[model samples]
Target: SQRVMETMAEDGTLPRNAVRIFWSSPGYSHCCFTSQNNLDPKLAAEIESAFLSVTDEDPIGKAVLEGEACRSFVPGTDIGWEMIEKAAEAEGLI
Candidate 1:
């Protein structure tokens, strides 16, 4: 995935300051479009769309999205680990 992102960056498929990535923990992660602050909304949208399009087609990104989907919407998930969930909830509230 990193290699794909690097290649895209090299090829100008994605802007250099496109995103700020964060991993919340326990396999969850997210991307923030920092480009929005520097670029217009349309340009930011395009960059995000391009990134998403490439990632959606990439195997690793597909797997990550699948895992996120399962954890979020599927029944009987490991999401019920209350200790971690409570921490996440608490932090969000703060």
Candidate 2:
């Protein structure tokens, strides 16, 4: 979950700029997310499918697939009041 960790470090949640797909070890792949916000469901599903298709039998691939699935289910920030607060905080308009 290095991507997730990185995203969290940059922004408090895993949002559009937080998640990414890349090769971790040889044929194995890794998907990391530092935040989950404003994620498109269709795109998420496609990414999930891609992760699942990796032929490498490495644990990193499995972990990436599981992480993708978990992230895919997360509702974007649009549905919550917390995002409003965050927005206000960002604009210094709170």
Candidate 3:
């Protein structure tokens, strides 16, 4: 990712010497799904499964995934979230 940024800067899409990657915390999702706590467990499982089932092989799945800039969905986790939270707080984004 940093290489891509540097290449862009070289190509003049971004100002040279202006690009800096202060922080990066991979494996942390930028968005999430939530439902009411009262939602039925079975229905919740179904919803989760449906999301995880999407892949680039199916035409509709490919379109949806590409539109959202996502490759595929995996089980959610809070891993690496603390670093992201700290970075966001430092930037006053949260």
In order of listing, the candidates' clash counts read 0, 12, 0
> Per-model C-alpha lDDT, please?
0.54, 0.54, 0.81
Model 2 has a clash total of: 12
Maximum-lDDT candidate: 3
Best prediction by TM-score: 3
Candidate 3, 63: how far from true, in Å? 1.5
lDDT of 3 by residue, 1-94 (tens): 6766877888989887676888866644646776767999999899999999999999999998887667997777656568877998999977
lDDT of 2 at 57: 60
Off by over 4 Å in 1: 1-24, 30-33, 55-94
Per residue, candidate 2 scores C-alpha lDDT tens digits across 1-94 of 5645675767866655555666554422123332255788788777766644653266766566465644232222233357757998999976
TM-score-based ranking, best first? 3, 1, 2
Better of 2 and 3 by lDDT: 3
lDDT tens readout by residue for model 1, 25-65: 45433422243245787876676565555444567777866
Inter-residue clash pairs, candidate 3: none
TM-score of structure candidate 1: 0.27
TM-score for each candidate, following the candidate numbering? 0.27, 0.25, 0.59
lDDT of 1 at 83: 83
